[model samples]
Target: MNLKDTAARAAILGTLHKAIGDELKAAKRELGEGLRAAKQETGTQKISVSLDEGQDIGTASLVQPKAEAAVTDAEKFTAWVIENFKSEVERKFVTSVKPGFQKKLLDQITAAGVAEWADPETGVIHDVPGVEMQGRAAYTRMTVPDAGKQAIAQAWQSGALAHVVLPELTAGGAE
Candidate 1:
């Protein structure tokens, strides 16, 4: 209402805005560092393929193969991997990362003060962020509760997984 009062209010408001901005920046910086560290430390392994001992896709297989049993097993396994690889790899990747993501989400949300997120989604989580509740559910793909897991799953699907499309391997030998 008065000049001095208005000036004082503006100064306080500006300082408050600056402080809030500074705090938010610090929060983001810390979070980024944390994520980097987690990426290094956790380093979730992708679902890798191992040839069955009897199948002979690798060094050992070369030595042991060509028997009727070996050939049949190899053929069956080749067919199986060919048919189910996309889904199998996808499933392994999802399963491996789900727990980590969920734990991260639980920690982040708890720290962020939104601890009441239901134990499980009443609806669906999507690999696509901001797409949950309809369309394609995404985060559920990796089965992780963390937003990072959701982001990673989406990236994995659209990035490497998209490129690889399908993978093949053979196995052989005795064990």
Candidate 2:
């Protein structure tokens, strides 16, 4: 295709991709409601559905109230970690304490679940300093067939989208 045609196609595809994304988001929201209803009807926190029974086209699973830990106040949390867990400090960060503590705390929090941890020296469980639980939602995660994976990879390797310089669109055709 010529440059003009390619650029036009890129613009159209961009718009279409965005529309498809919005539709997917709406569909997922509706599907989440349906998943919640299925959970309520079945009385199970974990639910799975197979779209094409024998063909294995797609699958979605839900784990209700999934909690992830997020660090809210890094400075206060780093100070708390340094004061409480001195030995767990990593020295490579910034020739100082805050960054190291933050990295260590993040690693520990990820190992433990949802802002929780065990004192390495004492063995008592406690919440990691400066962290809070976020995203405790009953969202369904999907897995679909990799039917276009090869084609997509080939397109990338072929640089099919490398030089798609789209012209700037102006409001009201202002030059």
Leading candidate by TM-score: 2
> Which regions of candidate 1 are displaced past 4 Å?
44-175
For candidate 1, report its TM-score: 0.25
Best-fitting candidate, measured by lDDT? 2
TM-scores of the candidates in the order shown: 0.25, 0.49
| Model 2: per-residue Cα lDDT over 72-166, one tens digit each | 87666666667676764555744234565566656677656668777677987776667876766677887655744454455457766343211
lDDT scores in order:
0.36, 0.61
